[model samples]
Target: MAASWSELMLSKLVGRCNNFFQPGSSRAMCKPFMVGDQQVGWVWPGVEKHIQRFPDVFMVEDKQVSLCPSLQMYEERTARVQEVMVKLREEGEFIALKGWRDEMYEVFHQRSSPPVFRMERTATALLGVKQYGVHVNGYVEHPQKGPLMWIGRRAKNKSTYPGKLDQVTAGGFTAGLTAQEVLVKECAEEANIPQDIALTAQPAGAISYFYEDERGLFPEIQFVFDLKLPLDFQPVNTDGEVSEFYLWDMDKVKEQIAQPDFKPNCAMVVLDFLIRHGHIHPDQEPRYLQFLENLHKTLF
Candidate 1:
């Protein structure tokens, strides 16, 4: 087994994903995609034609790329792109939108008519665009031990990260609602937390990383939060997405993270929590700085 959480998990998550087409300077290389001089995304070298299938929206010339210059154009072109993604999903594309916020995510520099692609298909519409989500680490005041945390086991039927451990609450950033709004809503829906309690969740910070797979690139930013619960409160799973909940000692939580139990991305959220709360210190972990800095990366 690896000595640290970073080596066993975070490194593999970040290190194994460097195969994306790196959009270089004014000179495009490795499948460059330009949206008005901004390389907002990229595609693997041999995979450009799959993107080329949406000829009207994407222009690939000599492996260099360009997108529709106007929002109106993308609005007109999303249907065909979605059609392909849907077919791809049937062909085994692992797209998931379990707790999707029904708002339209703004796409491209022009801030177009907010593309109508399905939340799952949004990645397909643009291969390298980044998406955002919200994650919160909920804890309680223990008069004797100080603090303990609430954790969830994702439902086995979940399309992604099934049966894995997760933070108290998490949901993706949808087209509508501020992060706070989503946080409150998710707290109630996922954990049965009352609105009054949900409103107390504080904005801790954010963690960003890059991930690529058969579907495409996901350079994501997760806004993290910390909510302290009433001494007697225990989370009840209102949403079926979470199968069960547990209030575990910080030591137990850290132990589980070092295993393959927590959801992969959730592992980093937990690591961030440990560092911020002084549970994981530079004096204890050899590569604490590198691990912290690597989690917040700009992978273009």
Candidate 2:
């Protein structure tokens, strides 16, 4: 006997939905779904609209089921996919989604956990492990020199990109902290900026960048933020995570970033913010020339 179409689809949906939840151990996290019998980690399921509106967002493989998004819809549908995740929690037959399973595990493990921010990790056998970090490119208006970007020269002793100019304040997001919480804590701990000052800064957005370290550990996501500081703000280094700080003129910063010293995607993200806000003048250099071209196309 063959499976009905709806039955097959439902099974696939359940499988993909279960993949979202996994257990976190002390050393590493456990992934829910297996890829060719090997567990894979968390994957962002595009946006909510595609999950609800597009038929192809869900798929099945070998009756053992594997799911992935259609390439055309992946970028535009991220938020939409996340929004409908709760629906799967309610309707799917996956053990992870069942409240009883989580409750039983909590009781058995003697740990209290929350739903939205649960920890998950990739399979242990993978050569490289990725971790998430937050970076803030802070800017303040200078009374005499216009807008200045805050930057830090990383310490030479650092394990990764050492002695290079980097974001003003950056740190790993520890357990039980939101991005906002991490940013505030990082600002104080790394740059000696007050928690109130960091908290008050507006969140521009996030950009994810990936890179690999010398040891084969992939520090995949640097979640970037643009923070506006007061004109009179002066930061002191509290923890020496940053060796030194400088307020660079926009042009100089852009020029320095274009060189090989700066981290690739991090520099580009800051340049994107500057170009979008018209701070980097079109007449300045080739970088701004491209920005102007993009702006013209965007406008007309």
Candidate 3:
């Protein structure tokens, strides 16, 4: 007999949970349980007895509720019951015949399978990797003289890009989201800029770059978008991810871009956008030459 949809879903969840509990375990050992025609993971300790007595109570409940409850009460009750089952399993007290039978029935009648992806911290890396992109905007004003294009130095505690200067508002594209989606999300998270502000800004085309860090573990294909902000726009860092922010004159930025410790790809992306937008002169003296040298090394 074929497994029911609920049974299949439950089995998959249990398999994932088991693997999570015991990382590097053999697949055969962690294979989901199969009981007769039903998958084993789908059968909670006393579920069979409840089914025999209640006769399709599980099925009678709204299918949507059974899958994902919109009601808070149903969710809370289901969580409490699952927690009890987990505790009983851990204590080995459920191995007794009566305890075992009761658990099976209680699980089938009271609990709903939880989502595999909902496990905490399990999704952090996935979330981070998914949010990768390039963002570009010109600070037409000089660092100190005009409205300096504020660049934030990353906090020393950061795992990536530690102590490096980054764009005023930048973000990487994430999975299931668009470039604009990422850019807007990033601005809010990194700079606390209102979503409304981001919506009104114009997109000035993207600068693409491939980068590999010294460790070679941090490889990225970045796409930077140019965003023009109002001269009066004042940015505040709501989060401590940035240690400090400083605005430099366009000339100051050109000098900073030539520094050896500066994050190469980020500086290149910013300069590329500025040069293309006519913010920086192509035939200027020392600053223009330095910019070209940096650009040449970064691109080639």
Candidate 4:
């Protein structure tokens, strides 16, 4: 028998996710690079050349090159690292990445509830560092039509994923906010969701993946969420970050997702929603058991 579109969608999403970790030891590549007990950030083994390129900030050895241990003496060495990163940008080293956001992302040795230290957000991926992000899958249950999902098309002028499909609410986990705080704030800013409604979102499990592309290695964590909006409530794009809003029925959503319309990472968030809501059942998917196991599995 031929597989259903839903089946293919689920399988492809899982396979694409696993490919990130399958190339090398998934766990090996995602290992935290530390000094003594302190985990400064993630470092890929093969990135010694890149690290060596900046000798002052990165102390390069034969096999490993890490930030100087003395950098720990300061409150945050991100300013020093930012200097090197800025020089690289000036020399045309970084392409396709945006300018500095003036926002700092926490670098952790472990996935601490509150991360370890603040680093310039722009440089983390360039340095093969792991970072945290939150994705909330906004949805509504119709009395007769089952569940419909809220999707956003990103603003064309945005630097990353411009004009691509995104979740209802998604943003990087910055230095000062908790996961829940980010969820609520992004919901309001991106979708005009009220605090009471956004607070109703349930904490779904998370997904972890690492991929290396022309840009750099992105070791990412997406904290998932499931939110059910009231039947009459319509999502409004308030911040202008999103160009439009889409309310797709389950079947239409499956078909739309089968195409390449959605952003790469946001697809995983939707797939997780489908599985948890029983849209994709065990018998419907060949990789059902494997996908279940991998969803919450962490490289960290």
TM-score of each: 0.81, 0.53, 0.48, 0.86
User: Which candidate's lDDT is highest?
Assistant: 4
Q: For residue 242, what is the lDDT in candidate 3?
A: 74
lDDT of 1 by residue, 1-300 (tens): 336654665554445322232343211334656666666656655447565766666677885677655523454445554554555455543343223223455444332334333234255323555677889999987989877989999999886779999999998776666899989889988998998998888899898776665445666779999999998887888879999999998988877875677776787788789889998878768768877766687655
Highest-scoring model, TM-score: 4
In model 1, the Cα lDDT at residue 78 comes to 54
lDDT of 2: 0.48
TM-score of 2: 0.53
**Winner of 1 and 2 under lDDT:** 1
Rank by TM-score, highest first.
4, 1, 2, 3
Taken over the whole model, the C-alpha lDDT of each candidate is 0.69, 0.48, 0.44, 0.72
How does candidate 1 score on lDDT? 0.69
Candidate 2 ranges beyond 4 A from true positions: 1-130, 217-219, 280-300
Looking at model 2, which ten-residue stretch has the lowest summed lDDT? 102-111
lDDT by residue (tens digit), candidate 3, 125-148: 211111135464535443446645
